[model samples]
Target: MTRGKWVAGAVLSAAILVALVVAGVRIWDVHQMTSDWALWPKEVPSKVQFANRDYQCGANPMPNTHSLDGLTKQGKTAGGADIYSAAPGTQSGTATWIVIKTGQATYTCDLMGGP
Candidate 1:
């Protein structure tokens, strides 16, 4: 190919490589964010008096997420005491529901600017 064409091809290849790298990095970051326990808050609903329905009836098994890769379930800690969101873009502030030992659900969310 001509010198000009070769240079253009090289630039295009470099651009494509850069784009791929950026995409991969972003994916990795998202994975880490969702799996991070520090980002998750404590007090997740562990036990509740469901007057209407059971929390374990496929409703409170755990926080689930639907992403491009498909449904991703939250992972429990090594102790298997609590669960957390494993997929990013699932919740607004925190991942799924936190295991709250005691608290008023409607009182206020410190992170969501509640009372």
Candidate 2:
């Protein structure tokens, strides 16, 4: 190929590579953000929950209760967040609140599930 053709092909290839990388990064970021709990579970006494202090509950007052019974149970704990559920049971709907504290951070959320 001529010199000009070679240079054009190189530039095109570089652009395509950069585009692919940007796309991949965006996809990964979306997955990470959605998978982790941003707030629902509780709060940290020192720090607020993800820029949201409007719903800061001190602790998991009703820990044993099955908010959802069978559908899906979700909560925040120890600055971490989780969801739980039972199997082969009636759907009692979901509970509304769960909270946990760790050092300077808190995780809080409303759960829905259990008998």
Candidate 1 wrong stretches, greater than 4 Å: 35-115
lDDT of 2: 0.41
Model 1, residue 115: distance off in Å is 26
Reference-based lDDT, each prediction: 0.35, 0.41
Cα lDDT, model 2, residue 12: 100
Candidate that scores best on lDDT: 2
- Please, what is the TM-score per model? 0.34, 0.34
- Shift in Å, residue 112, candidate 1: 22
lDDT per residue for candidate 1 within 17-70, as digits (tens), equals: 999898777655543433223323233322221212212212133333312233
Off by over 4 Å in 2: 36-115
lDDT of 1: 0.35
